[model samples]
Target: MDLNYSPYDFGIHNDPYPVYARLREEAPVFRNEPDDVWVLSRHADVQAALRDSATFSSVNGLRIEPAFWGPDAERFFSFVAMDPPRHTRVRGLVSRAFTHRRVQELEPRLRELARAYLDPLLDGEPFDLMTDFAGPFLADVISELVGVPEADRGEVRRLGAAIMYRDEESTDLPPEALQAIGALVGYYAELTRERARGRRDDLLSGLLDAAEGDDRLTLEEIVGVAILLVGAGIETSMLTLGNAWYAAWRHPDQRARAFDGRVADWIEETLRYDPPPQALARTTTAEVELHGTTLPAQSRVLLLIGSANRDPRVFPDPDRFDLDRDTGSSLAFGSGRHHCLGANLGRLETRIALEEIVKVVADYDIDTDGLRRIHSTNNRGFATLPTNVTARR
Candidate 1:
């Protein structure tokens, strides 16, 4: 085992695909100290582990550092911490909300919301695509879905950013941040009770009804799932939006093809090339052998989802972002039992955002001078992207 690459101290935050490529080739399962965890870099290994939940459990929580969960770490780590029957039960209930009918119903409204934000941002002068458009677009959509008032959306965005910070040193959330999470949880809990009491016609109401039996999700579970859904929704979708715009501006030919119904494929390529959730953690429930190394029970396995997506074994010319190439099963969304229940919703969000942007904004350029990455091990995205966009004349 050549002990050369420093997985913890990866300097190239701007472009980490190269590092992931190296890890996949040399040490498929690399160990690092910054987070003090073992990273699985190969696609096959990560995929297998994701599918085999019995060996690799989500119980220890998905974050590398415990602080990523902030104050509600214990009280809110339900959906992400459950295994087997419990995991299936909770996920199934939430899955009902995002079913084809519900999401399809939400599409027209979602597109209207996209246009509402996009048109304002597309006014004459240069605007930051991320702050002015992507961020607000996603934040607003999630807010509307969870019954958040339009006025409170900013505060929600603020707290969401603070709580989703990736840098291990970012635990100092202002009082308002805590309040934001509490308010969100309180709102959802009340909404859950309301849906339970009176048969409402919304998705939240359906989830509330789903929590009735012995396998019923607890109030805490309801709050946790709501928080997870809302937080995860805004962050990842916004990241995809920003990344897609960046990818398009960088590749002119690709952008043209992307506009022609190939944006979904392009988004898939972007995810494989540079996913928002760069890496994920799973605690081993039993001794497991991966790549000739014996991982003891309870040992944490850090799946480098971005790395796996770029593994040469799985994708030919893995580094190249070819929209036509059928890159098999990228772990942009997690695999197996605990896979993202909001996968379809996330895709719809990204697709609609791209469609709106591509149609309204003609010329674009990345303002690399001030771009910043969110500081979180669990979620990878930009905090501030100072880009200039020209609306179609």
Candidate 2:
């Protein structure tokens, strides 16, 4: 069977699992010549590559797009696009500010934010979950964390959305997206400067104060970290919340179980079954052989995270969204040194949002015909999910 896969293809974005299944069974090391990328579909291959970051480097960024791929990828992805000493140092500094305590401290505020955004929507009117709730909720959370003023949060969120968006089957960043990037960077740079002057009880101030002896983050690094939060933090969490909501809506039994306070399971199952990050790009450091195919040094590789999560070798009944299944092996937040630093915060946000939702929503139905999927290079989620909910009596 002939195999062809392009992450930029809208067809693939619509439903990549069937193609992923075929690639795993037929072409474990599938190559897409048009995109100039090698696709790794098997669980073992993807997991191994993630662990072996030395050979599968992230220096060129975790994307195949010309604009996002290259040595200067650090401009957009921050330390996540760096390797070795650079990555270790930058990540360590950021960690001092982005501590577990910081995330845990947000719990009370997260619940408050969840209810603040979700409460009004329970009046039984149809609302787009993405726009009405998920989008704004995450905007508030990240903005508050990073010290983005409440007045600017809406615009910041809009810019964040523009940066992640792609046209149908588009291969490169659009002009508007580029502008949005510039705007966001400028916004963060100014914010970072402000925080340096008069500190606040927020991550931005914390970042300014974060130091390793005499070593501290540079202005550009702090701005980059803030941009990374907008790019990685907001979009992923918003999409995850929408994905989980849609997943449960599709499966009645699972939906019922989720409503019965299985909110954490709901989040985990949604993450495994339909993770936001479908693929992660890596550049091969040296020649490598896998599945009888040799990948050349510097070749672009797309580790199909969505595919790996569904590999039967790792997950039984892979397509079934069962909350009972162990989802430990899922690469939803990725793995190894480059593993998502915001994983805990993302989960916490989703949990609180959904928990608040379950409290008010007795049952709900998605307007399937009206559902709109966001076209993106790496993320998979809805741009609009219209729904009507039955409020609890």
lDDT (tens digit, per residue) of candidate 2 on 181-270: 999899999988888889999999999999999999999999999888876778899899999999998899999999997999999999
Alpha carbon lDDT at 87, candidate 1: 73
- Stretches off by above 4 angstroms in model 2 are 165-171
Among these predictions, the greatest lDDT belongs to 2
How far residue 64's Cα lies from its native spot in candidate 1, in Å, is 1.3
Residue lDDT tens for model 1, 1-393: 444433244244456777777788778877675556788888999999889989888776777555443323534456766787777777787676557677666778789988998787765666676777777788777766665556767877776665544443352444555666777777778777876777655666666667435556677776787788656788788887777777776788887798766878888888777788877778888888777887888777788888888888888888777888775678989998878877788888898888877787766777788777765555566776776777787
List candidate 1 stretches off by more than 4 Å. 1-12, 69-77, 149-158, 161-179, 211-215
Clashing pairs in 1: 165-375, 166-375, 166-376, 167-375
On TM-score, the leading prediction is 2
Give the Cα-based TM-score of candidate 1 against the true structure: 0.90
Consecutive 10-residue window with the lowest summed lDDT within model 1: 1-10
Q: lDDT for model 2, please.
A: 0.90
